[model samples]
Target: MTQQTENRTPERGTHVYDPATCRVGEFQGKVGPHAMLRPVGGGREWQADPGKIRRATAPERLRAGVKAANERAGRML
Candidate 1:
């Protein structure tokens, strides 16, 4: 994981993740220890963990979640 720097700003086209609400958004800027962005709401801003945002939106995590759910249902190989 990349250590966040005090001077580092959110990448222009990067995505933001909000663990509090389990939501993702286009990167805007830093709003404290988290990334800020406007999500589904009309021009509303939210903060999220940068690393978690990436992981939460990653295809692998999605696949893992699906696999886990399937396993819980006794559908895994």
Candidate 2:
């Protein structure tokens, strides 16, 4: 990996935004040079190049939590 890529990855459990896909996900861990990210509601994870990800803003995290909450509510019904 290049020096730039090495510095781009955030620690696990961090929220990140994938500009290429325009989606937000939690940085679960790393697989090879790619970072594994799972969607807010928790589903199949995707591997993204860390160089393309940025830490999610505070608002993004709030929205993700809301989404997860709604998903959880649905499971109870």
Candidate 3:
């Protein structure tokens, strides 16, 4: 017999996609440093320097995921 299952792991400090602004909001819900929102175009982006997001354990991976999602959605990110 063959079985298939989906992985439902909760991404930590991952970028959340917002269709309205065509940008990805990172470090959602938390403020002060680390909080960032990057637009998905024009090579322009926003990022927090001294926030938890900066210190996030998975910053690189999260950013990559965000970028991929943005591209898939045809946004800048």
Highest-lDDT candidate: 2
Give the worst 10-residue stretch by lDDT in candidate 2.
1-10
- Each model's number of backbone clashes? 0, 0, 6
Candidate 2 residue spans exceeding 4 A from truth: 1-6
Candidate 1: segments with Cα more than 4 A from true spot: 1-10, 40-42, 55-77
Across 1-77, the per-residue lDDT of candidate 1 in tens digits comes to: 34333445567655445566766556776666767766532247766665445523475345545654666678434
lDDT of 2: 0.81
Higher-scoring candidate on lDDT, 2 or 3: 2
Q: In model 1, which range of ten residues has the least summed lDDT?
A: 1-10
| Model 3: per-residue Cα lDDT over 1-77, one tens digit each | 11111322224445444333434444333244333455433244554432122222355446756766778787533
lDDT of each: 0.55, 0.81, 0.41
lDDT of 2 by residue, 1-77 (tens): 12224575577788888777777898998888888999987888998878778888888888888989999999999
RMSD (CA, Å), each prediction: 8.7, 3.9, 12.2
TM-score of each: 0.43, 0.79, 0.24
User: Which RMSD does model 2 reach against the true structure?
Assistant: 3.9
Off by over 4 Å in 3: 1-57, 75-77
